[model samples]
Target: MKIWYCFTPLITYVADTPEELIIACATMNSLPVTIATCGDFGDPIQHPPCDGSSTLANITAIITSILPSDLIVFFKACKHYNLNGVNLPFWRNWFAANPSSFLIPELLHHLHKMFWDHDHLWCTTVVGSQEIDFRFVLLQVWTDHHNVQWYIIGVIAGAAPTDFISAIRALMEFKYLTEAPHFTKKQVVHLDCCLKVFHWLKQSIVDTGAWWGKGGGDKPWAIPKLELLQGVVPSIYSHGTVMQWSTDPTEHVHIRVVKEPSRAGNNHNYDAQVCRHLDRRDKVECFDLILQIYDPTLMKMTVDKAAGNFSLPDLCPAVSDHLN
Candidate 1:
């Protein structure tokens, strides 16, 4: 069976992680859990949680506490998860779905975004954007993540330290493997190895002070997306290859279904206009389909008749009179 058939896309995108947690909680009918906080600075595992509530850890028990009748635990879990009130999300009733099981790996946002936001930013910071841009301009043109991975190591060679380059290379390799249309058991093992190598070598970034974002200080590497790397293999095992469900196809359709339709409307209350426009379009398409079903040759005959009726005079009446 095709992997795409296994699941349908819902909630195309959310603005950020907080919104994602909201949706995830809503979907599961539970309160949101803030798994990004780091507590164990002494642990070698960078940003390891002191309470060990990394999103990678099973936090479903924590989320489930909000659903019970016990107001005390419910409110306590609410405060712990950083929620405003004891009100349970409306989606807790959704059957057979949880964030961990349902949220498949996305290449564009997960892998590419991580590269651009964290890794690429660090590289540019360390080696300078002008130098990197100069190297990129000289290289042959490539598109998407390939443009970044094709020769990032070669481009930044000797300028960046060996450990930094190795970490990036490991991530690039993991991304490439994840993009494969099909994977073997052996390939899965290799994928895990790539992640392990990345984790092992990523300390160089901390030592050199490249981990420069919000989760700084003892939690220099507390990136939600970076932590998401651990779940990639499990997601693939349960869902299929990452390519099967990547967001690239949805993004490609966004312009046609959303952006272009929205442009047909006035700036005010445009979303309603776009919906109305799409409804009209869908109705017209349905009519066309019904006509074809009734008479398969109708469209072709109409096109032929229209073409035959056209003349130079019809196209250019002034020029046609002169010719006559």
Candidate 2:
């Protein structure tokens, strides 16, 4: 007989920090970096007013430019950016890894969240939430990638202006392409084309006053996740696909291991209580596995008895006689 333990579920407690720190860690160069500042995009610091003269060539130049932070100059830049309350984080010395490359495409936040948060709002503004919801109800489809792929055109076609519909369709195409299980070289080029089309047509949303600007005018597409779209194809080529490193499983783990366990504990000193609860749960599971390996009947009977609601007397009149 042979037994193999394939996976051991465990949680590593990592202290959460602000977005700035994460960007700093990923790039290793720290911000006011090209990606964060839109410096590569020919946009000034803080994404100043759109000069309309910003040509396609200027826009096309926007690309991911992560430089090595190990350089002497970058150390000063890290300090300037106030990363980690130190000149450089300690992990950089020990972990010789490019996290920025690995940290490429997280589908949950990168796509789904961006869709709901920004894109959905722009869409609602363009074609009114009431009309969109009415269409969705008529289609009997939930809001998801499938909703976008199959029925989005019908949902928004007549309600939205032609350019707005086209822009959304391009974005939807790009989203589905990015989520494909595998991609050929040709598909990658198609992905790029979809993105380009979306970018070019997205100005229509601004033109229609759908997307409001911070300074009280229509804003250009300066969102981080939208910019992150540029790196999706590169990430696919470097890694297998977005599915390989999707954050969905991680989010599931958070709910099962973190949130559920925390709820089991009393509010006071719950962290240690949760840890103890998980350890006990793991031990009980392991013990059950051992029992099942040795004698499957024992484990099966234990589970049945544990799950059984009625006593022996309820099952047998003879048992009641014995008790009496």
Candidate 3:
């Protein structure tokens, strides 16, 4: 059986220490893990250049050590924290330099024209605020799946090219692994497009100085290291496909199902809230299963009778004729 693992902000709270986190991961079956940030991990500065904490480094090393080498791990960069380090400053400067041009209609128009001509892929833009008052761009990448219709797998904010390029590269790599044909001419064509776009974006970032630009700081600096971005290509090449391995679906469950009810009851008691959410979900699932197994036609007839429309002919003359 295939399983998908996700390390999100909420779940990370279950483990207090790195060792505990490793234990929690061990409990899960072999699966592709999508790693995101958590408050428990503390600040990035605590672990890296600033000090030798190695909280994240240790957690990830443990995860990789236990999981198979081919196991796909998706590193979702947090926009709030600037996972790449360069995002905040680069975008701050980009907005300042451009002035009224960041995420404006003109920029969006150009982006849409350049990227959305193909039917399979498209983008959506929303106006968002950052740092409380400053405005930022929220761009979402969506794909038209032959089975699932439209699904958004990536969301990138700010005007920095590195952020955009990185997000786009991940999305395209995912598409190549999940959507492309296998061992066929179509596969080659699809992969060519993916590589072409990937290279183009990387080159654009370098050429435009977006990779190494001065913004919200003293001097121009090199792009911040994003360890998550490093594994994407290799994982795709090793694992045949990354389909259904993303955290988007789990995220949707949290946002649409868990958070609201938890808040409505008692937001303060984290453990109780989680327990209640799980209980409610299980009950709901069982009810749905019961409905699925039960005959629907009987329910329809009962409803019709209760509404004083008991005549079968009134409901469906064809059914009445067949009965006669």
| Per-candidate TM-score against the hidden true structure | 0.66, 0.66, 0.31
Residues 101-174, model 3: lDDT tens digits: 11111111111222342212222222122321132122222323322122222233343345454545543453
Candidate 1 TM-score, true structure as reference = 0.66
Residue pairs of candidate 3 with colliding backbone atoms: none
Q: Over all chains combined, what TM-score does candidate 3 have?
A: 0.31
Which parts of model 3 have CA positions greater than 4 angstroms off?
Answer: 1-178, 181-186, 189-203, 206-238, 244-249, 252-257, 277-324
Q: List residue ranges in candidate 2 displaced over 4 A.
A: 1-23, 26-35, 38-79, 82-91, 94-96, 142-150, 215-220, 263-273, 302-324
Local accuracy of candidate 1 as per-residue lDDT tens digits, 21-129 = 5645422222122233333211223232212122313235555554546667765665555443324443444443354455555787778777888878778877888
- Residue 118 displacement in candidate 2 (angstroms): 1.4
Off by over 4 Å in 1: 1-20, 26-77, 82-98, 142-145, 237-240, 248-253, 294-298, 301-324
lDDT of each: 0.63, 0.58, 0.33
RMSD per prediction, one decimal? 8.7, 11.0, 17.4
Candidate no. 2 TM-score: 0.66
Query: Considering TM-score, where higher is better, how would the candidates rank from best to worst?
Result: 1, 2, 3
